[model samples]
Target: MFRFLRGLVLPEAACEEANSSSRYENLFKKLDLNEDGRVDIAELHAGLKALGIPLGKDAEEKIFKTGDSNKDGQLDFKEFMQYLKDHEKKMKLAFRSLDKNNDGKIEASEIVQSLKILGINISEQQAEKILKSIDADGTMTVDWNEWRDHFLFNPATDIEEIIRYWKHSTVLDIGDSLTIPDEFTEEEKKSGQWWRQLLSGGVAGAVSRTGTAPLDRLKVMMQVHGSKSNKMNISSGLKQMVKEGGVRSLWRGNGVNVIKIAPETAIKFWAYEQYKKIFANEDGKIGTVERFVSGSLAGATAQTSIYPMEVLKTRLAVGKTGQYSGMFDCAKKIFKREGLKAFYKGYVPNILGIIPYAGIDLAVYEALKTAWLDHYASDSANPGVFVLLGCGTVSSTCGQLASYPLALIRTRMQAQALLEGAPQLNMVGLFQRIIANEGILGLYRGIGPNFMKVLPAVSISYVVYEKMKQNLGIA
Candidate 1:
């Protein structure tokens, strides 16, 4: 009997279209209570009520007035299906129009255009308002899935209703929505600002120095003697240094790195923010391409100012023994030994690498943060510690992948001082040596350590900086 019943109920051909049709038919039958093949007022009210919606007499009257096309005080299944199909068609058309690139994705630019066409003038604030409403993944893009789920799959058929629903959605009300406390006084704000600046400086410097240290050591080892064996590892390299020069050798040129970090990060962050603000909507949100451009420009600006210090740091880090005493002595010796141009020996590759590295890093971080929040914390107002950590990891990975080759070249150029009477290696010489001697793989020798250094260093830096800013109420 059960088998017979199942056979009777289930269709033989179970294709997607068949399943969808079955679902629609089931829905129709469920709504058409009393086996009447039609939905009466009582049946509609009961259905709405079952769904936990209050459909009082007044609400029923309004629904009947709009949905009852035949003026029969009832809804036949055909009429109801027609109404739903028409609304779905309209929504699909609207979605297609908004996805101007026809890439099946609605970008922020498309949203801006769509809003304009809908007769809504979107100011920067208004754009942010709308963007925050629809950007489910926080990637700042409004792909079809996000648009459909967040905007279209609702009983609110009109644009106004959709907007209203979005305005109240949990996604839009996250971290930035809460009201400031009355006890947050002016003195507290000023003190917080002071501490924030200090913290930004300290954290930025520490992260920069730490990230460069491993790379500095690896570059020196490779330049003085190529990474032919397992001795290229950090532990092995340290052991070699201890045997030759002593414990102090490991910290070679650390002073230059520490000193350079402050200016490098200060300039980089400041420039990044400025460029982001310029290209972004006035409310300080940007699209993916805009974010990339802004970050690249910022990196270029920062690297230009500090590339000389980078060269000096690398030179001091590498070598046999006693090439220079410390950061200051290194600078003096480089000036005396090689011309001032020696300080920028590998400027080309370094500058080029900075463009992709910074842009990809920042963009990936923001994109990952949005993705994690959307997927894991969609109902919450703030991302937890894990989300921030994941974002940092993603950002570091993208940056390192894009810039590893250039990093190798820069290291080689800087460590060229180890070679007896070797002239300053330019971009060409560095590339040739790396290719001819070690094959292509030589260029990515310390990638594992590079990623390890970057991931934690960048992750901690950003997480700390963001938390500090949030705690201090400095958006």
Candidate 2:
């Protein structure tokens, strides 16, 4: 399968210590940015960047650590050659798997078939996009020599690592509970790691929401009752809660919010995968537009499915402690008094808000991650956890800002029936009434509390999510 395997992929004694073929020297020269006899971490990363091969922080770090066997913080030519030789067998096996039909070359169709098996759908054009990166002779496919040469310095030993190195951004948790469901490889799904990931995410989300429940409650209160006549800023809002029901009342509605995380996470994950499968282009590639569409649709599907919980969360958040004993009492009262449809009180605006929020969130996160990589990638592979948290926070905040007006409307509509003498408004009527009565600023009434909770929520979610993933063996 690897008929053109270079001498560099041979035993170290034979390829490096015994010989100086131009091929090995040329490859080493590509990685030796300072023209020294060895390659350092920065040079390795820069060299890979120059090759148009992008890798994530973890992948880049792994390559460097594994290759620098002497603990010297650098790779001499011999170490470089030895590392390549050790990894060549694995890379060769990966190539053979891609070279379906045993043709000794990887074609676009093969790429399509291979990825489909891995649960990723890409079009022929997308597959060619992959090939064009590795295809040197313009043959529209990759031969053994092309494959080996392209990946000789790459740290990925298997197809999966290669996929990870190329398909970035899904790396860090970013602390956004509303993030699109992460893509899982077919192997992970089969091994049952998918559930562990979802569980970790759900636990993280639950912890985060609970930690910020008071702020969330305040935000809901502000959205439902904040007005020109009754100015309920954070200070007054919090003080009112303590006066009415004491400190514990701040977490009045958090139980239901925490309870709904599991189902919502699972639904989103499953729906995202299904939507990707359905919307993929001819080459099994999901384009930017297609991905956004799938993600939005997946988000909507999950939101719609768990919408009852949204109504519950809103109702509980705005209610006084003595008004409803707990989530079950609140739900039972609503079901009996308002009928089945009460659970979907604000379905319209809630669904409408998903597109802009998901789209902006995805776009901003990508831009920030890309910008970070461009400016500081050579300095260090890992951007550090705080950097990731910052990116996620800004992106999610932007999303909330873009969609907050609609969110406020949804919360109000969901809680409206509980308020005496409140106007019953559809999505449009709510918009008109809010603008007319509360002014443009009223639409952002609860935004202070909502934003106030973001940093802590993000920090808690990120920490808990990482710990959970580690405990669950979700590498």
Candidate 3:
């Protein structure tokens, strides 16, 4: 029933619990603080933390509820042993379910066939990729011992429990909106966590955008007007805005910017799902390459549909104070003066930027996450919030660096009509002008403000999402 289990392995534990009673005893003793010969919740947490197996409050409670069979508040040595024994039993059963030939070892073909029997068809190549992940020693197959060791410390009691561990991760709106949207399990859709997570992310994005609107506007201004004759540093730019509009104009187009988040997120996720289905093989599964392709296409679809808003945001961001009343007024004037095509002025460069931006962002984020889980997967594979934030920031910054010039060109295109004496330039012409006029470094005109907002925007979004999720009773 849990289709997400098709490829995923459990928490990578170091212990090799293969009917080793002494090993189990040694583990129990480490957790049984104060020599009580029984492990309490506090002692369990401390022991696990020492072993790099940090647990949230809910995870600890679930462990006690499942392992403490006598309704006692603590776990005795027997209870601890039973927990491991039961966990091992579950792992073995999963392995057996996939080892269709009853060959004691699991092959890629068996995994694909097993999942197919259960109506979750995946390709042999996809199954092989999954096989390589858990296959010890590059044997390309998983024996009982190899399968057992992969999940020795896993707290899940069954397939459902195992996948439930990943549910917490789906809500993290990591990196920027340009990064791929997190995919939800089928269970998440049925359990109603998917919509809640989206809502939480949407609200977080709104608040974070609102909080950092000034910096965003300034970045747009610097991109549009920063040149040798018109040198607009952050300080001079903000002072100019304040001088003209009395300190309130800093967030000029924030309303439109915030309004676009809900639709963009909704469309992106919807389009991703559709693309995933459309690109899936005959068995209704796709590999990593196909997945990325689908994700990039989905992002393009969303950005294309919402390109008008992009143009509006650029216009308002670079517009003079009281030039147009608001987003609607700005749109109306642009429509009258420049026709409907004006709203899609920067469409080409914006779409082109998404390819490099989403590609590198997704690539680096996956690489970093995989490296972390492979090398440092301790008691739980779930990364700490700070660790996740660090990974997201680094990958996102790298993506921005790769695609910054295109983004600058897009902004320039959007604001070209409004700029007096500005020549009409396509994406390539604008790039050439910037490089020729301001040197190569000119391609990164507003990079300072853009980078400055990323950390706080990401941090604020994360904090706000957590609070909103709690308030919405997502747990």
Lowest summed lDDT window (length 10), candidate 2: 1-10
Q: Per-prediction count of colliding residue pairs?
A: 0, 10, 0
Q: For model 2, how does the per-residue alpha-carbon lDDT over 135-242 read when each residue is reduced to its tens digit?
A: 766798887767876676667667865764333233233223455667766666887977887788778888888888888888989999889999899999999999
lDDT for each of the candidates? 0.57, 0.76, 0.75
Itemize residue pairs with steric clashes in candidate 2: 121-284, 121-285, 122-283, 122-284, 122-285, 123-282, 123-283, 123-284, 123-285, 124-283
| Candidate 1 residue-wise lDDT at 449 | 51
Task: Compute each candidate's TM-score over C-alphas.
Answer: 0.54, 0.71, 0.73
55 Cα displacement, candidate 1 (Å): 35
Look at candidate 3 and tell me the lDDT of residue 292: 73
User: RMSD in angstroms, candidate 1?
Assistant: 16.7
In candidate 1, residue 396 scores what lDDT?
52
lDDT of 3 at 323: 94
lDDT of 1: 0.57
